[model samples]
Target chain A: MNESAISIKDAALDYPRKKKGVGLLREFITGRFKKIPRKDRWFRALNGINLEVKRGEVVGIMGPNGSGKSTLLRVIAGIYAPDEGSVEVEGRITLLAGIGTGFNQDLTGRENIKLTGSIFGFDSNSISDMEEGIIDFSGIREFIDDPIRTYSAGMRARLGFAIISNLEPDILLLDEVMSVGDYEFRKKSRARIDELVQGDATVVIVSHSKSILQSMCDKVYGIHNGEIVTDGEPDSAFEFYESEKE
Target chain B: MGVSENKVLRRDGKLPFLSAPVKIMQNLYNYRQLLKHFIGRDLKVRYHNSILGYGWSVLEPLALTVTFYILFAILSDSEDPYRPLTILLGILAWSLFAKTFSNGTTCIQRNSSLIQRVYFPREIFLFSKSGYNMFHFILSLLVIIPLLINYELMPTQQLILLPIALIMILMLGTGLAFFTSILQTKARDVEHIVTIGLRISFYLSPVFYPLEMITGGRIPEQYAEAYLIANPMATYITMIRSAFTGAPLDIPTMNLVITFATTIAIFWIGSIYFMRKERKAVKFI
Candidate 1:
């Protein structure tokens, strides 16, 4: 009963750097004769990292660019398999990264809702049940039938957020998506997220916005160079983060 | 509250060979809804802005059939009345393999955005590619029915082999795709190499000519069995044509068995290769 909602222990992932000017033909001819060292070929995006977020806990991850924040989130979401260690999670996880992560641009907003809903493992009937709520929340009912490509960036973000939020995911992973859309939409999205958090859903947010981290997170971790620099109250994490920046 | 079971994500260890395909099939079944949506999206997006839409699927093979018909008519003195129908079937069958090979190679890279953002069985993209092309293949097959009627040919027992042949072609194409899609993500050149390989295979396959040209004494008769077994596409295309024309299958029973086994082996090997390489390959993509 005390099990954490998300547990990542000693997780490490390497991003393979592409070989320059290496074609399959050249590799076929020379591969037998050549022995390229594998050690220098990969850029490790996530180092040996351990994290635990208890059930109903709201956690924030703050880091600079290339600090492996998104990669860590992806590992937790099971989008990337770590080169070492493991990630275990309880409950249905939903990750909303940017404007439209899984959207088909050619599909209308309405169609994308169904498609994305299905991707999240929802049956069509449940997707249909949430369809109206999502459209109303997005506030783009007039353009829901138009192809999503026709929507503005804010509109697309609103639609993406609406679809995911209405699904009521048990574990929600947000990767810098809260900064999207205009002031009003952002306020509405924040309210909805607060409501979800109040319902005891586990939440993880990856962001550089200090205001967001302070307001939404119960605890914040500062990551630098694929390693956690601070794991404490938001003020200390931001203090370490700001010092690292200097 | 009860402790819910935790789902773990880690680097997969080597899977036992027998369980690999079964595990993949189970994963696919679990994601069947997404697969359906993907296939539907593939079909809809393909024909979205085009004027002729689905007609384009039939037109390409029909145009090829005509070109071959006119060329062979001028060159050869004897005419096989089933030449046009046979040629159309060959083109349709070959295109299924060719399109799947070419498209499936790039499918992973094409959907990199989706792949990076979401976590689902990556095989869905490859399967959806083949599934949608299979849809086109079936649609184009319907066009040949009128031609079959024009030739006064009705359904026969041999037609049972039609589905078998089609599935074999699909497995072969999907198997090849599974290998190339992962490789293509690592190196952009794999798709180009596949394109060249497919071009050579088109001339080597019996797309324009009858299988008889090869088996009917073009090569020594003894090696013909080996050739059919070696090149399952030849056996499949020949089976498809025979299925429609009701010509007795010229292939020996043993060769058919070996070819079927080879197709399954390729599919199995491809799935295993895909599952193994996919995690590493996505990093490069």
Candidate 2:
């Protein structure tokens, strides 16, 4: 009955690192990403969060490190589900796994371009059509046919960002990836964000950069200790977040 | 608390990629390409500094095959001239299986840096091993061609089934791999134990010799048969040998049932455990 497209209720996240005691035999039975042994040692990455985002809205979450800022983003991305509470999400969510995640070091730049395009949901045939645009946007025309590993991280990031930007998702999540590369390129990334914002897309950005969130976010919440300490104006949230800093 | 407010704007800007969860699977489907990229990366990285490069894939198995052949051909007291062929079947299957399983065992742990932060599906990484291992397996097949020619063995219509046979090995590998990748990542020593386990299994599995070789001419027939069918890797090697020898596989129709059921069960348990562990895998790294 709720009209909100995304909702989280009392969501909490805990992660286990390492622990001793489980008999030598049972340890191998556990999954690497599970929280079986860290019962006492687990870090409460995200405490509890209550949120609702409707269609055609943009929300920003900002906080200090370990304040569940990135944890919140990861939970929403379905990378982590809350230990408790229900997370009901409607519509499409686009989670960027970074620029280099979908690229190959061994494959030629041409091959990497196609590979990246495919990860954006386009088929090889479709990628071939967009080949020229990818090369142009990346601005590494000469290296387009070379293996991507030979390219610098900047070049790789540019190529990666270029591929995803073309896919056009209904909702987009960014995790400080835009902060990479040069100032000129960051400006380009911001401009691209503007393009997505103007459309029907809903957006969520996680960052420690107050100025950037203040300038671009319509509403921002300061998340601390796994709960929303303050929610409302980005200026006020940032102010509250900064004042609370010890 | 609700996004329904029309004047919700707090005079702040917006967030980045608002719909990441909804896009997880969508991105993953798109990730088939990404998976290929990773597989390509692994293969290239493995061969990077080597002289023969990927030719090593073919060469390694070939050399092992030769060592086994020479020992059985001229050195063994057994009069069976077919001993060379038998050893070839065993070594090829064993090495590939051991290499794939052990490599996959560390697939996630080695990449923990990326695993802890990234929002991509973890299974895709487990699946990436499948891709890379299979690629290497295919490259190794190049050796089979020359070996076949030297033996004067003609290609058979049954060779079309080779792809199917290899898929079975991978499916079996996937079950062990998917399970072990998660298990070892959670428990560090699991990989070390599995490394030794594979070594012992190489000697125990039907790879270096037929199941019949293990049971003397005096052992009960059905019991040895049962062990071959039950030992996880045993059937895999048997089927592989069947591929080359053109034998009937002698597996019960129900054997496929067992393989199918175990495949699903291992994959199901492994995925559940991995997903359960997904949140924590990040913390360790």
Candidate 3:
């Protein structure tokens, strides 16, 4: 309904922690009687952050480890609700977080394609239509009938990327997924990702690689200690990130 | 862009408890395919590496029936033509309830990887296990029913109640499953506790022996009603057995009335408890 694909105002999310020396049994027994034990600590993963991403934009989030990069993505993906504020999003979003995150190892590549496609909301007819293309793009047509356990890690990544990129998601969320497959497939995947982003689709990518962010993102946000320290063009964000590293 | 910090937390983002039934139904409709995938995956994984595969479904309960059949025969010092059939029916009913709760307890933990990655409703895991066990339970029935027909153990009039009894048992089992599954996420000991409870429950229910053994001579007449009413499994077992063996329903009408009420009540409470706890339980798991 709105041109902005994602809008967040003062959104905050906390990871709860149980107090030390309190056994799980005590917690369970007390919880059964409607007595919730007080949380000893609340780690703020995302804190008082405000941002907006417009339609058809590739925004990259560069942050150090444990700096809330993944948590921000999860909050936007509706996996975790913000504790302090609200997030409003429009469009169908698909998140590719890791290599083969949802695949069943015992299922064959072809069957897994069907499973993954259906989970992403594709009907049977569409899955059948995209099956051959996914296999062809992965270049593992010969091994498509074998169980996914037999595939190498790079091969699984190939298949995962092939299926995800083919789904034509409205908003694509990528979390350091470019560092996958061999040299050749990685180059091919980069080109494929470029093609996907070139469409009228908004993309939010999280990567630590400055070169990738500089080459791909229109705007880059540099985060440190759970706060956005730099929000500007890619070159300036990368400079801020480098300056922070020193 | 101008932005203001909102102080009041809007709990309106989530649907209220009264809409739980409608929410469950809508989720079932929207993620019907995902549910199917989960069931299909669980079934395939269970049978894929096993030597006997589907045979185990029938053989498991059948083996347990044989053990009890022999134990009862030796202990009671009597020969009954329909003894094995009666015991088989009891085991079938009890196993369905036992397996659903036991498996349902670990459904969330088993799928923790998927839970961490995706954003689907967590109850899908519990229902998947319950649905898969139900399929196996129904398949085992295919084996038992033929033996029943061949032996001519059919109680024609009471046969109408079997479907109703089976549905009630399913509701009760799933309800307990929802409650325990949420608890199990927080404390791993819930599974062990449930396993022990089901074992004790099996003996308390009328599995190997008929209700007559308990009500006739084993206990005082005054305490019989309370005993039977306390264990809803006993009522379900009797209902199922009477459907085939023409045995008289020993429990009172009040007990049956209470059993039905408790069955529905447990399901309602279980679903509400699961829906509320599941969204937050993922973090603990």
Candidate 2's error at B195, in angstroms? Answer: 2.1
From the highest TM-score down, the ranking of the candidates is 1, 3, 2
Error (Å) of candidate 2 at residue A186 is: 3.8
The candidate 1 chain B region of ten consecutive residues with least summed lDDT is: B1-10
TM-score, one value per model: 0.92, 0.77, 0.88
- C-alpha lDDT (0 to 100) for residue A202 of candidate 3: 85
Q: Output candidate 2 Cα RMSD.
A: 7.4
Pairs in clash, predicted candidate 1: none
Per-residue lDDT over B1-285 for candidate 2, one digit per residue giving the tens place of the 0 to 100 score = 111112221101121143432333453465666677677777777776566786765666667767776765665565544455666666666766676777778877777645533345666776678777777766665656655666676656655546765666666666577667766655677788898888777777767566556444446867765665567567666666666766566666676567657765665555555555555554554
Off by over 4 Å in 2: A1-5, A17-39, A90-92, A95-102, A164-166, B1-54, B111-121, B146-168, B218-230, B247-285
Q: Write the per-residue lDDT of candidate 2 for residues A67-137, one digit (tens) a residue.
A: 77776876775556567766766554566545555455677777766655544445557777778886777
Where model 3 places Cα greater than 4 Å from the true spot, the runs are: A18-39, A229-236, B1-12, B46-52, B77-81, B246-248
Candidate 2 has a TM-score of 0.77
Higher TM-score: candidate 1 or 3? Answer: 1
Which 10-residue window of candidate 3 chain B scores lowest in summed lDDT?
B1-10
Model 1 alpha-carbon drift over 4 Å, by segment? A19-34, A231-235, B1-16, B47-51
Best by TM-score: 1
